[model samples]
Target: MDRKIFRLAIPNIISNITVPLIGLANIGIAGHLDSAKYIGAMSLGVTIFNMIYWNFSFLRMSTSGFTSQALGARNLTEATSVLLRSVIVSVSLGVLIILLQYPIGQFAFRFILSGEEIKGYVEAYFRICVWGAPAVLTMYAFNGWFLGMQNAKTPMFIAIFNNILNIGLNFTFVFGLGMDIEGIALGTLLSQIITLAVTVTVWSLKYGRLKKYLRYADLWNKVALRSFFKVNADVFVRTFLLTIVTGFFTFASSSMGDTLLAVNALLMEFFMLFSYFMDGFAYAGEALTGKFVGAGDRKNLKAMIRRLFFWGFLVNLVAVIAYSFFPGELISLLTDKAEVIRVAKSYTFWTVLIPITGFAAFLWDGVFIGATLSKEMRNTMIFASMMFFACYFIAVPLLGNNGLWLSFILYLGMRAFVQTVIARKRLKLI
Candidate 1:
């Protein structure tokens, strides 16, 4: 059991780890180059993409659930069909995104950056980077399919390849080639293209013998597609809510003005790192629970959950201890700005707080996804989101930024509690 979990999780951890590197890479590259506005520009620019892309994150999340369920049932054609359907849906969404890019770009820039200099750099990055939409979304589908198949190594390789490409190309275009944001933009675009291509090639080699399933017929079959849409739609709502919740933090931080905006932006990297690390185990839970439930092996499922929960808590405790023990050293990795560091230090509690507060929520989320319990997940998020805003509205005027961070801690903790209560009700565990 340990071997199975570790086999699946290590690559996921590595793959999951690089995701943060993608944003931080942009921030780091921009930060090291010159001015604060550049960092602001990069952060806001990426946030805009994040808000947009993250809404569609259900494409990956739902695909994993459905595809893994199909694989677990040993329904090869259905599993293959799931992959086909996702690629078509994801690609169509991407093309639609490009067609309407201008207004979207404008709205994002006007709202997020607003300041003239930062806005200009952000718009420049947006224009050039918009071209990667198709490739990146396609890669989202590919990633989902790979994880669903219990093959974390493929994504690990692709993610590593994707980042190395992004970093190297960013260096060439931004510094070595003098492209600045354009370099970063172009590097990002090409990396997606590479990731998508390699993913498709791998899919063919590993499972392509089931080629009959990979047809336009599979892509648009209304009945199966509707099921796909329903599952993904539920997941989309779940992720959309997540986006909105995070958007609040962004909106609140941005409202506090640029220094706070920028500090929260950098501090987000710290908290994002903790989430990224925890997601490693969450991904493992998703895979293991999917396998067990699909096989209807309830006993193994229960045992696996027990072990995974322990693993999740132990790792989080270590993270909290590390954050508590060594403060400044971790900050230096993110920025040269002492102000950003100082402000981040003040709110370091979020880091120490998130692992304990949020870890169970993530583990339970994996279990829910593995069970494909979208409605229940929706209810939990809805309840938690309400608690967050209520807590935020009540706390912010009194606590300021610390209150803002506290709302987050409350949000994660409540989300876990609500989910736990619901899970018991659903399974009659009580």
Candidate 2:
């Protein structure tokens, strides 16, 4: 029963691809509309949700790390228990988010977004998407569990199917039904609900035998629960910082005016697109690293890192080539606004460089997360974030929009450098 890395990576790659495919699909759906306002609105709205939900990404990351460790120890019982606890926490948080959507949207807009028009779109998008929080969060937990067990295919299936459904629904509602932003919201909402159901069904069929080991009693153990909290707390800080940085990117873009905001948003889409692809390899690293660490196999961990870094470099190289050739083609497809396209073209240099500066950081995130070195992950982010702000304040006043882009590139560079430094601290690399 030797593990085939590509076998695992293929599914993850498929699943990861769907995420940005959906984003592109959403932008495409909105692109058909007459106004750039729709484009800006959807971008702002989604960024807000991204900030909130991304902060809780630990639900997936922590669950994968913990469950993979248990599974590696040949403890199916503990694996099931770990998953159950993660779902409970994820769903509880989801409920709280849905309930506070209105106030949250208001606060986020006033504090984070720069204008009333952007706020209006952001609020409208949130109002509709809030209802789907439970489904989305639950998906995160299931995605992690499946990946942890070396079952990337299941999550990939769900991710691809969900994207297909989302795209179809978006077309129907936005164009056929004239639904607009409400359509975008409903598309994601319905798609997530379906995906969650499919995930559970797959879980039952695949990991069903382990259900017998379901021990609700274990959730009460202070020692086990304490470890869970410790890991999650560290991951939470890391995720929160991630969310805050994302928020700052959007907020800063918004402050630069509507045109630059749209430009920055489109630029972000390019970076996020590249990131989703890179995440597939990181995910492979995360799952494999967690398993190897849990089994106390440092040799295999090194092997996994070598293979992942190889693949990461190749993949990012392709992205750099793609973005370099036709940045306009991608931007035009996302929005119909000619002005937005022009601005985005002007900033293409930063987008092209993003894959280079940030690729290592994204891949290393998988490595660190799989190892459940969340405290280290948190520390890396803290340093990177501090660098982000220090660079931003000095650059923003002088360079304006270009400064923001360069700062972000540096932010990613900082993340990689800091993570590598901390890895040496933990692994005694020196």
Candidate 3:
């Protein structure tokens, strides 16, 4: 069990680490530009993408859960059906996003509230990057299916290669060719297209023979299609509500001041960093739990969840230690701005608290997803999101930024608590 968990978790951890580094690289490139507006524009543009992409993350989660379960059941046709269904949905949704880009761009900028100059850069970035929607969404389906098939190394390799290409291209365009923000957007578009092609080519080489089992009719299997949307819809709601908390966090921080916003952004990277490690085990939990459910191995499912949380807690502890012990060193790496560093240092303690409070939520999310217990997951997220807002309203008024951090921690705790209650109640059903 330990060996199986590590086999999936380690590669995921390594790959997930590169995700944030890609964001940091974007920040690095933006920082070199002449004006702060460039950075602000780039951040806004990326945040919009984050909001959009995170919502559609259900594509990957659902695909992973369903595919893993199908594989465990030894249903090759079902697995093929799962892959096709997800790709079709992703491609359709991608096209919809393109059609709605005009309004989407307007609505996003209105809420973000940037200066005209920054907005111009943001608009330019959005228009170009929007074209990558199909590729990005397609990649999500591919990655999820790969993980479902217990092939973590492939996605890990692809992610590292994709990010490296993105960063290299961004540098060449912005610094070498003098393309600026447009360069950044174009680079992302091109790299995503390449990554998608690679994913499909690899899938052909490895799982192409499975094509014999694929029925065009399976794409619309009434029962299977219903289950797909039903599960994915619940996940979509859950994810959207989750994004709201983070989005609101950013919005609220900006209201406080740019300095506070910067401080919180830097601190939030710590949260992102912690999640990369925790999510590795969470992904393992998803694949393993789904396999157990499909195989009707309740004992192993329960055992998998236990071991997942155990290792999750230990890994989060390592993050807590790093944050607590190396606060100065980590803060310095994020920025040279003395004020941002000082403010970030003051809030560094939150990093230690977050991982411990949040690990269970991360791990259980995978467990629930794997089991296709989306209703429970959805309910818990809704309740937790409400708790977050309630706590934020009450605490932020009295405690300020610390209040915000407290509310965020409580939000994570609430998710774990609620999910635990649900898991206990539903243990017999699966």
Candidate 4:
């Protein structure tokens, strides 16, 4: 069980780590440019894309869940159909995003940008990068499908390849050609397209034999299509609620003041780091849960769940200890601003509670996703999100920023608690 979990978890951790590196690399490159506006423009452009891409991440989550179950059942035809249907949906959505880029860009820029000087740079970047939507979204499908097939290494390799190619191209375009943010955007676009080609090639070389199971009729089977949409829609709603909670956290922090906002952002890095690790285990839970459920192996399913929680709590302990002991060191790594560090240190206790409150929710998310229990996941998120707001409203009046952290902590705990009850009642796995 440990080996199985690690097989999926380690590669996923590496993949998750690489994801943030690309953003950091882009920012680092922009920081060395002629003006600070370049950095702001690049950051805004990336934020817009992040918001767009994040909403569509259900493509990967849904594909992985359904595909894993099909594979567990030894239903090659259904597995192939799952892949085909996911790719079709991804591409269709990607193209739609491209077609609607004008309005999307206008709406996003108007809400996100405050400075006119940075707007043009962001617009140029958006125009170039928007064309990569199909490739990016399609890759989401492939990555999810691969994970469902119990092949995390492939996704990890794809991410690494994409990162290296993107960084190299960005350097060549920006420095060699003397271009601005457009060069960075172009690098991202070309890398996405190239990496997608590589993904297809990898799929062909490794899993081409599965093509024999592919049937065009299966792709459009009404029942299968309906189930797919149902699962994905549930995940989309859950994700949207999650976005609202996290986004509101940031917004609320900013309302307190810039220093408090910086403090919150800096402290949230601990949560982000813990999430990256926890999410890896969650990915493992998803894969194993789907497999065991599909095979109707209740014993193994329960065993996997136990081992997953063991590892989850183990990681949570480590995170709590580190956050408690090294708050200043971590804050220093992110910024040299003494005031921010001092303010952030005052909130370090919140970071210590983050892993304890959050690990179960992260792990359960993977398990529920793998089991295709999307409705339950959505319900729990809805309850938790509402509680988040209620806690914030009631407590913020008395506790200030600490109230915000308190609300977030309770929200995380509530999600885990509710999901645990659901797992016990529905899956009988408590």
Best by lDDT: 3
- Please report the TM-score between candidate 4 and the true structure: 0.89
Cα lDDT of model 4 by residue, 1-430, tens digit: 8999999999998987787667667766775676645655665677677678877889999999999999999998999999999899999999999999999989877654235667788899999999999999999899889999999999999999999999999999999999989999999999999999999999999999999999998889999999999999999999888876776675566456546755665566567668877888999999898888888888999899999999899989988889888888876665556666677788889888889888999999999989999999999999999999999999999999999999999999999899999988878742
Which ranges of candidate 2 are over 4 A from the true structure? 1-3, 112-115, 428-430
* Model 4 ranges off by over 4 Å: 26-45, 113-127, 170-184, 251-266, 336-343, 395-401
lDDT of 1 by residue, 35-148 (tens): 766777777778778878888877787778877887888877777888777778789999999999999987766666346777788888888888888887888887887888
By lDDT: ranked, best first: 3, 4, 2, 1
lDDT of 3: 0.86
lDDT of each: 0.80, 0.83, 0.86, 0.85
What is the full ranking by TM-score, best candidate first?
2, 3, 1, 4
11, model 3: CA deviation in Å?
1.1
Clashing residue pairs in candidate 3 (N, C-alpha, C atoms within 3 angstroms): none
**How would you encode candidate 2's per-residue C-alpha lDDT over 228-345 as one tens digit per residue?**
8998999889888888887788888877777887788778889888888888888888888888888988887777787788888898899999899989998887888887887789
Q: Between which residue pairs do clashes occur in model 1?
A: none
TM-score of 2: 0.96
**2 or 3, greater by TM-score:** 2
Candidate 2 has its poorest 10 consecutive residues by lDDT at 1-10
> What's each prediction's TM-score?
0.94, 0.96, 0.96, 0.89
Per-residue lDDT of 1-430 in model 3, one digit per residue for the tens? 8898999999999999998887777766775576545655666677778888889999999999999999999998999889999999999999999999999888877766444676788789999999999999988999989888888999999999999999898999899999999999999999999988988898899889999999988778899989999999999999999878887786676566656766776777788878877899999999998889988999888888888888997998789899899988886765666766777788888888988788889998888888899999999999999999999999999999999999999999999888888888897788
